[model samples]
Target: MEIIVAKSAGFCFGVDNAVKKVYQLLDTNNERIFTFGPVIHNDQVVNYLKRKGVKIVNDIDEVNEKGHIVIRAHGVTPVIYKKIKDKGLILEDATCPYVKKIHNLVEQKSSEGYRIIIVGDKNHPEVIGINGWCNDNAYIVNSADDVEKLKKSDEKICVVAQTTITKEKWHEVNEALKEKFENILKFDTICSATTKRQSEVEEISKVVDLMIIMGDKKSSNTQKLCDISRKHCPLTFKVETSLDLPQIDVEKIKKIGISAGASTPDWVIEEVIRKMSELNNQEVTKNEVNQEDFNFADALEESFVRIRPGEIIKGKVIGFNANEVYVDLGYKADGIIPLEEYTDIPDFQIEKEVKVGDEIEVFVQQINDGEGNVRLSKKQVDINKAWEDVEKAYNDKTPLKAVVVEVVNGGVVASYRGVRIFVPGSQLSDRYVKDLKDFLKRTIEVRLIDFNQKRRKLVGSARVILEERKEKASKEIWETIEVGKTYNGVVKSLTDFGAFVDIGGVDGLIHVSELSWSRVNHPSEVLKVGDTVEVHVLEFDKDKKKISLGYRKEEDNPWVKVGQMYKEGVIVTVKVLRMTPFGAFVEVIEGVDGLVHISQISNKRITKVEDVLEVGMKVDAKIIEMDLENKKINLSIKEVKPIDPPDNNAKETGENKEEPEITEHKEEMEVTLADVIKTSEEVKS
Candidate 1:
């Protein structure tokens, strides 16, 4: 029989590190050594350690004396660490780095109001440790059915996987979760080492007649490997060591494959290989596989092109999920680009951008990214090309489009082709930016003002682009501007004197008097900053770079309605505005005041206008004459009939009586000649 040994059949990096730490502690320290649990899943290793005076304690309370406590590769919860400190035990942490990352992720996500979902065996020690980080409130789902049983909710859900679980299981559980939750965050936390070992076993089992899966029965990853092997080859046997090797028919089995779990020791694999070689009646070395019946496919698989880190390669898109895309790199292992490595655009949609059978170029980040998949980065390639273009644009004085991603202390951070460009607050616009957050998620054109290639620093200015456009527009406006020609403009600012409006990049002043036909106390009464208004150019001084704009339309002038609104012998109600020595200036309408001479104050004789009429008093009057040319009106209060006073008896008895309503005819008017006469009389006095 020919033997094919899986290359990835031994202790993985994390398991090796943990076991080595235990042995090193055993030899260097004279004090008693204790492990939080069995150092690994293998029974032989644990028994051997026990023989060497290493005590295995399931709980912290079980340790009666002080000693060096080594945490196992399967890690412990935060409470366990606290207990170790309380008991004054020296901790030699051996938790896997990848597992520690999961702890941190769950803790942070849970604090951010995400419901944590762990896709793995609930009883597993690793899952338990991860659950502890999220306050032990995580939903542990082992299969799609478990996920289906969960009620659908709008709460954001963050999904993570046990390091040893299969990728298929992780994906399956995630797919089920997507059906129930709209906002689900998935982190494929499966250990890369476990993936490689499982993948190797699946490939070997396909060609082998008999397969031997070696690892402890309690090992979850080992059991998964056995299941994969059994599905491919019916004559699959699981064994803990050489002693457990099952009886095999040598005549029927031409090729036999051997694989081991991540926690299995190298010595155990070698011993098993030795037993298999003896059965084949041949001497075999660890590195040499029987080549008598080796096929061309196996040779070609081993001779596939070698890949190196930092090298650019072309690949065909084979598959994709929300978090990552898989590409066939024409090598033994396919490449995977995580979502973060694809693009920096916040709204980047992978499905919309990528498709199967599409060929693309990628930068190799790692030849083997723990999970036996080549780690690739499309963003790095884009950023590399983008920086070259950015530098060229900076030297050529060209503008580039960028999306704002964050608002920082001094400026906003914008992303252009995955590269971050800092646009300072002063550079955001020509006008002051009151709130920087308004620019977040907005795309704007920017010019590169500063570039530091060595330090990877890039500073951009949107204001520069704006200024250039405005300069061009100002030139055009100056060449084509015409008096009385209307143009749409945006109000830039408001002041007591006037409003500055931007009409096609040229700022023109709109005096407060020109804002409306009626009198205005301030420009803000008619126009505010950012209001769009139709303004006509009243006049301009080319040398002074000043343009006066008119906002009030002629149709809106109050005097335009005077000829149609009022005529001679018209009855009206007027409000007394102020008292002059000769008469009281009474307002007929807004911006139109008529004088009521002291002689016309009432039918009864009065010495002064103030004797019968006080300021702000309303009275009935008739327009006896109108000077439309000079915009004046002569009013006489004596021409209109007045109502008699109420009886004193009725007033004392509190009798309610309905008074006739005075109808006041209102009309728009401009400054009347009455104001000129009143000013001259006041000056003489």
Candidate 2:
């Protein structure tokens, strides 16, 4: 006969804390001591406290005046706290630390611009307190699907669990809530005490004959322990006290295991164990307990020492078998680990976090019960720890080390803190990097920018590093650069009027005509994006941040040659560039132009000059004059060619019908008396 009890089979820190708080009030205080609610979910403990002169009060108004009012371990709302304080009653504050943390989280995150979500039963007191702290902005939800009612926001949100929430279901709720919110902060907040109790019961339930579970029926976590045990052995039964159990069939039972709820007393666990121990000595011809039933013993025969499945033990690999490795988990059974778990070369003689004889955490996945062996998963433990780290990174805004797995535009993909973080194209380096892949497989430090716990999305920024590098480069470049010096630069951009050259970190313009000694119609005709050319800096407008530059300084000025081509009143044919209201600059020769005004274009009465001439038209023009002082030219298009008149000298050979065209006129005005007298006097002379 064998009896095995879990090391952590009974009530934990929180339940003990609450139980002690109520007992102190009952022992020392004289007033009608009353707890606002049950001190814990356990009715057995609550009823025990009631028997000790403690009364449970459902309403604040029901409390007697000046009574010693004890707030239950589940915690009370600030509204209720204030109301009780206002009543002038003596108060006992006994809220558990785990529950109190949720209250504080609600207050802090709500103040810092996050809406609170409470994951648990709405009727629970802890969640009610959590809701009150946020001015009722907290929404209550029970299951995974219940999160659908929440309105979406780009704003940050805080999620917390009720202290007694089941570990696995809490995961479901957390995963579900995180899916809808872009910015979600999840605080597991499930009391550590609750986790210990659950894990203990889950592990203990495996090898027990008939198990006795001690807990109050109303206790949620206690009921959870009972449910976990029944999956292993259906004979396990729940009993609040010894009164609930019948006389045991000691003759048939040999190995019996006993576990308790978190609220169950230590004395209670001891009493149950004592009653079962006497059963092992009965006259029952039971099957013997086999130490070799655990799979770890079977793997050792093959000299492979790794933990077998379904056995929780620590181990270090000392040697290997043909198909497995050996780990010595300091138990009676040498552990056997499958070789498949070791993917790479055995990482020994290095900075190993674990090694042979080094203790490590692993999950018992299965028991090779047939071969007296077990299968354990080290990878599962690593993944579990990884999720915890990823959650911590999401909470703390920490920078993590990662390898750049792939290069993408503007950034790289790096696995940081066990999450695939996206480095955007803008963040690949400290400066502008046109090629991102060069950084692939290279280790880098990255800060997480965008992350989600539910979707497991993480985004990083290498651009921040790139920007920092850019600033440093700019400082160095600026230190040596002067306002008027000349440097070689690449033409980075071209426009209709000029080209923009990248002179170190600065950009300067090169006017189209200044590009060469001859004509330049457009900047693109001579320059391209990467063309390296030398230029002289003419002016640096510090206020405007504009740099005026000149090209073609190595050659003679094109305008100097123009002075020789044009002269005043020199008629020269030219091509029209553009027509303005005042005049048009006509290219009489390459790079030499003269202006032809609208008035000089034609001899006829002109209403609109555009009606007669169009741009890009090559026509004859006469340079009537040039103004060298003003760099202006005057031109004439009308004088280029003169139209000849019709000839009148041809002999008239056909019809005489035109004979009446002109009449001979006499009697011109008053050749009056004065004229007649003058004519007669001249004749007499």
Candidate 3:
């Protein structure tokens, strides 16, 4: 059997970065410095860093400035940053650059208007850092389907990934979010280190009959490597030592491939090899050659790095055509990239920008297309370059300058750095941008969120300026409302019970009964659209945010000075303001009215009130009685009567009466509306 070994097999850029940060602190700072986490998932690197003076701390309370406190490469939550800041302790951020990107994505996306979904283990330090940065709540989903948490919004959603997660898993989760939201902002934050290792494992499994993968159990990227490799060859086993090898058919196994994770040192891979060589009677001893100095030049010579679908590459423009371009890579052949690859490159006049023989760079997308042409990409190349610039932009805390490219639901699409970032309706301006059309092609500043380079999704905010102004507006209006003082208020809304008026930032209610001085059939009768009227604050409960507002305050009490207006048995002119079954309502003054009882309409054989007068008709009536305390007025319309009956019904009724009658009866009543109104004023006093 032929032996095959894979290339691109060990520590990635982030892991290397994390490991170096921890060990470097040991050389200068003797003061006890603590890693906010274990530094990186690699136990070997962590153990080495610990010997060099780096220590692990799990909580804020556990941290103090003995010398310095370092945030680990996995990153820490913003909550952690605030706690450290509050303690007045020194903080040294050792978080990997990729992890910091996730933090900024959560912070900006959550602040504007996006439901943040982190597709990673919630227990992981990187994901925890991401969730902590968000102002709006963010949830973590570890697998393809996690129902306990889902996005809740009518607006679009944003999705991000952990830097260590595999590209394939990220894609699966991204597609799932697309099922729910009409538009999804997905950021593929999966680091290049993770995909490279997974691809190496996949190739190794197909060639080898038996595989030994060495890694720590807690290493996420290591676990993914085993998972990817297992699909092609089921005979693979993950172990930290030679002791984990099960009862395999050792006699039948000939060709074996051995690889180690980032956390597994080269010495460990040698130990496993030494044990395997012993079984096959091959003398590969630790004494002859040091495994630490093992050469990988042979592996490199045989291997040609391949970029799978969804992998990102950074390159530059070299040459161009109407349909395609040629890029000079250090690869075996110059890469041929299609024009479609530059979908996001703006205003492309390819030949004007690029010329032949220009040293251009690009992503090695595919080893070969069916036509013997190696497929390459410029867009993916730009994203990788953009990430480097974006990281700088975040560190400076500067606003992203961009232009609106398209109008999407609940937001506008703005292009920055050859990538489109979503600007929510609430983030399009300091206040809502009423005319989004006006924003088209207009340049503005934005703070981004939910950014994941792997998924290519981002959300941004511009409304922090708006909310500050809103608070100022609210404060100015609150000072004007006063209880028991009438002022002009405009009606805002109508209901069966009341009308709500916008006095300022708050609202006040005018009960239907308080709408008019008289009994109103409906409040609409006295108030119309845009009516300006005086009102009084009857009650105010600031704690409850409620107010009892009153209208018609201009009409004062009618009984202010009752004794001077009317006396018993006075005659007056009045107009019938309204009619009731028991009496006719008559107004004799501007603010006063009285009732003329039916019995007081006439003293003769009169059966009906319409015979003398109808509503709105003026008449003379006598004030037969008065009640100042109760505000009642008694008047009569028929004080003068004929001395005898004119018809048979009256002729029959008159035989029972003695005739002091007609003159006394008609003269006893008859008063005018004006007299009754004045009398009501007198009685009310």
Best by TM-score: 1
Q: Model 3 over residues 100-212: C-alpha lDDT tens digits?
A: 88888777887778888888888777787788888527767776677234654467577888887888878777776666667678888887766766777787788778877
Ranked by lDDT, the better of candidates 1 and 3 is 1
Cα lDDT, all candidates: 0.84, 0.67, 0.67
* Candidate 1 TM-score to native: 0.45
Report the Cα lDDT for residue 176, model 2. Answer: 81
What CA RMSD would you report for each candidate?
Answer: 22.6, 26.4, 26.5
Which tens-of-lDDT digit does each residue in 1-685 have in candidate 1? Answer: 8888987787888888899898888779889899987789875676566557787777798888988999988888999999999999999999999899999999999999999999999988999999999999999999999988999999999999999888889888888988899999889999888898889889889998999988875688899999899989998888877767777778888889998998887777777888988986854423532222212234434545788999998987756778998776767566899999988787778878987657888999998665456899999999989999999988998999999999999999999998899999999998889999999999989999899999999999999889889999999999999899889999999988999999988999999999887889998888788899999999999999999999998876666666578888999888999998887888887867788777775655455565566678898998888886787788888779642223431233323322211111111122445677789999999
TM-score of each: 0.45, 0.40, 0.40
* Candidate that would win on lDDT: 1
Q: For residues 27-114, what per-residue lDDT tens digits would candidate 2 score against the true structure? A: 6768788778677765445544544667667667777567888776778778888888888878888887778888888899999989
Runs of candidate 2 with Cα error greater than 4 angstroms are 149-153, 246-252, 281-685
Superposed model 1: Cα runs more than 4 Å off = 1-339, 346-376, 404-413, 422-444, 449-464, 562-601, 607-631, 634-640, 643-685
Worst 10 residues of 1 by lDDT: 659-668
